[model samples]
Target: MHGSRSGRHRSDPGVAAAAGDSGLKPKGPSTLQALTDLVRLVGRSNAPQLRLRLVGAVLLTLAGKALGVLAPLVLGAAVNSLASGQGTAAAVGWGFGGFAVGWALVRLLSSTAPQLADVVFAPVRSAAQRRAATETFAHALSLSLDFHQTKRSGSLSRTMERGARSVDFLLRILAFNLVPTGVELVLAAGVLGARYDWRFGAVAVVVVAVYTASTFALSNWRLEHRRTMNTADTEAAGVSVDALLNYETVKSFGAEARSAAVYDRALGDYTRAALKANSSLALLNMIQAGIMNLGLGVMAVMAGFEAAAGRMGPGDVMAAVLIMISLYAPLNILGFAYREVRQSFIDMEEMLKVTRQTPQVADAPGAVALAKDTARRGGSIAFEDVGFRHDARANGLEGVSFNAAPGTTTALVGPSGAGKSTIVKLALRLLDPQGGRVLIDGHDVRDVTQASLRTAVALVPQDVALFNDTIRANIGFARPDADEAAIWAAAEAAELTAFIRDLPEGLDTRVGERGLKLSGGERQRVGIARALLADPCILILDEATSALDSRTEAAIQKTLRKVRAGRTTLVVAHRLSTIADADQILVLKAGRIVERGAHHELVAHVGGEYAALWRKQTRGARART
Candidate 1:
């Protein structure tokens, strides 16, 4: 059986209150607020350089649009010259030269400006994305254990990844596509109004107005479909990841079929959502195409009539057609840009929500680091009337008080759910008591910086989760800067060196995910080795040897006896025989200590809770023998 870490800690009420109010669901920021935040975030990225580039980009955009509008006029002049029977070779050459130059310049500026803007803006965009991802990741790590337990790891990862990409996409669309398109629209309308009859400008403005209205209305309608597709996609990924992470359990229970069914269901939902999203997109495209083509046809016919009536030359008709064609390009992209921008906003807002959560446990203002001198004295732990409740109903520690004097070994023994594991977590300050205080080395744990406090204590949990790396790396995690000699010494003390040496790779042997490649006993030894390497004043063995066989347990117990010589040890154990030599033993029932004494002293009480437990275990052992 694999050793498992006990989830016996109480949830923080502050975290609970926050979760109740915010509900952990993605609550997107309002559209206006999201846009404002995006702008602010972009502005924060190397402001001096970004502002310079932004100015240049804007100027280039205006110049490009100006040339774009002027190109049609030049083409019109060339056509008019040819139609007026001025067909001389020089005249035609000059006319066509001006038209070609104007058109070429328009294309050059339109394409070149955006490329230059991208070059200047790349660093700013990258910086903003990095800041957002880093802050969000750190915040997620800082949140309460309860929050992490309730959230899916895969979903959180996707949120950060997608959110960062969305920032880049949003910036590109706003700067290169949407803003420039608006400028071009205004310039085209102005040109038509100044150089032609009012009807021409009116037609251009009306077409744009209608196109904008239709795009907005349809894009808003597609928002729900896109949101649904995103949700389904995230869910599918989460389900697949969760199923794979528990690969052993799935295989053992012959749950491969069931897991596949669950995954298939998730994917099925995603497929349906994707289909709907694509279908709606197709409809939007068709509608936009119809609107654009109809506007172009109407404009062309009106220009032809104006030319026939002598109010405009044939060159004016060609210019009108070219301008309308140019406007169609931007209008074609408008729907897509709007939809993607909206989705990006939603992604960014989701990431912001994670960053907004308040960490349940934080270093208090003016919190100080643990004194090195004090920690060197072998940390003493005191639980001064500590109390906590998991919830309104669940059993939790109640007025639990104990002391583990420096260099002493104290053991907690109890039935499952008797708050034994909770005491261990509290001692390590993994969870804070709602009432009273926990002190280490005479300083309240809450009053010290967590980093410094944790440095003084180390835990060898029953389930030793190892990263998918070499055994050497896992052991070195406790004291990352420890020399190879120290790490080997610690591994030897944990009785793991001989086994590691027998392996083909020695210390370099890879421990698969969570050390699943190792036997349960081997994994526990790795945990012990890591803790020994840490060399902290206080050592917490939370059923650390529970997975080992009797022979391995005895050997590890001998190693632990030596390791505990100058450290305060707190043990939460189910094996009565293992902890018989403890200096003090606590017998808990419900949420409180019902009996406490040395093993011999407790056994002498006959009918006492500890004595009864010892007798029951002794009888069971004799029967097994």
Candidate 2:
């Protein structure tokens, strides 16, 4: 597609109006903002080579448009000279051949110059797209966990994908095609007016104005249809990815047909919306073509009359008609360019919204890393009157306070909704308490950089989500610089050595998507191995052994006991047996700690929450046996 002579980003207000602004103004952290950043990036790059290419691109664009306009004039002049010449036959032949060659050469340069310009601008475009994608992706990742919890994986991925591609499209269409096409239009009109009758230029000007106006109007109207289609597309993609990711659940529940039906409906919605958009596009194209051809016919008629009256020659008539034809050449993509420009803006706008998001949890200004000596001492954790609430949940932490001395174990166990997970999250600085302070080694976690805090802490969750990669890569992810021997040691410590050695590929075995290829016990072991590889001062196990079978659980628990030395450990376990030996067992009720003591002391208290839970579990186990 193409654009008009006016600056679409500034002069034309429809695009901006459609986006609830004016002319896809390079404002906000949107596509236009990306462009603004791109310009600043190029200027700051200190690479004169890129600047030279940019300048070369501009010169070539103008040179291409100029040659295009001159080519038709040369052809027309040749025809006029041949007809009026009284030269010898050989002279006439030479004159005809010379003009033909000259026209072809001009035409060749016209086409080649634009292509060469694109080649010159390729690096700039690539860099712009790469930076935009990297910036948005990094920003999204940096956002708080709450943001990700509410976002659909498929929809977010699609947005980032489309937005990245949009950067490339916008740069090309805006810089090379639409912007230059508009310039070419003005140049063509000026040439027509200067070399021919004033009426010819007037016709060219009116045609462009009307074309640009109508195209923008129709494209603006078409925007809703595109949006509708995109919504459906995103929904369908989200549904499919969600269902596939949980295919095990779907099959276990016998919901395959239901899932397929849902996807089918989503696609049906998308198809209808796409059809409407495509139909609107066809209508716009027809209108554009009609307007362009009408102007051409009018120019030809005027030229013909002038020729008949002997005011102009045959060559002038040909040149007059060809000028309008050549004008339509780049203007041909008017509708497509305007439509895509708006759509790309929308896509990039969505992605940029992510980049603009303010993380609920951010490091305090002038935050510093944890003291190495303090971290080496196992990073003491103290929760002083910490409070947090979830709007949707009935239970939340309330003045929760505890201190885990360095190199000791503190266990939290309670019924569901007791906030064990919330405490874990707070301790990791994944979330900040709404009130009160969470401190590590007497320094408020908020006062230190998150990176440093995380470096000293590691958590092994109940369900470990792993990347689809080799066992070696997954285990080594926690310590990217860890050598092969370190990885093997960690794996061996997690009791994964035997199982991994049994596999044909050993550490090289692929762990499929989300590590689904590995059994729950195996995945848990890999998670433990990864956490172990970090060699963190503080270790958090949130039901880390819940996925393992009884035998594996016992083995892992033994491994954990051995590895707990010199590191503070926080364990949240449903199976009371696993944490029975913890130095301190805090029994939580609702969101508050109701009982705090050693396991033996808590079990000694008759009818106490911990004692009751211990009896119930032991009784159930005896009954099952």
The superposed Cα distance between candidate 2 and the true structure at residue 130, in angstroms, equals 0.4
What are the per-residue Cα lDDT tens digits for candidate 1 across 1-625? 0001111111100000001112134455688999898988887765447777777766776676667777777778768776776668887788777776776776677667667767776777788887788878998988876678678786788778777777887888787778888888888888888898777788898988898899899888876665665566666666788889999999999999999999889778767866676677778878888888889999899998888999888888999889878877767778767766766787788788898887667788999998763444578899999898776448888888989898999999999989987787777777888988999989998899989888889999989899999999999999899999998999999899899999999999999988999999999999999999988899999999999988989999998998888899999998899999999999999889999989999999988999888899999999999
lDDT of 2 by residue, 1-625 (tens): 0001112322222221122211232333455575665466455444437778889998998899889889999898888878877789788778877997898999999999999999998887777677767877899889998998988776677667767777778778888888887787788888888887788888999988998898899877877775676566656666788899999999999999999999989888867876776677678778888998888888899999989999888998998888788888777777778767766676677677778899998988999998764435587899999999987887799999999999899999999889999999999998999999999989999999999999999999989999999999999999999999999999999999999999999999999999999899899999999999999999999999998899988998999998998899999999999999999999988899999999999999998999999999999999999
Q: What is the TM-score of each candidate against the true structure?
A: 0.91, 0.93
Count residue pairs with overlapping backbones in model 2.
5
Which pairs, if any, clash in model 2? Answer: 2-333, 4-182, 5-182, 16-21, 16-23
Alpha-carbon local distance difference test for all models: 0.80, 0.83
Off by over 4 Å in 1: 1-27, 46-48, 373-375
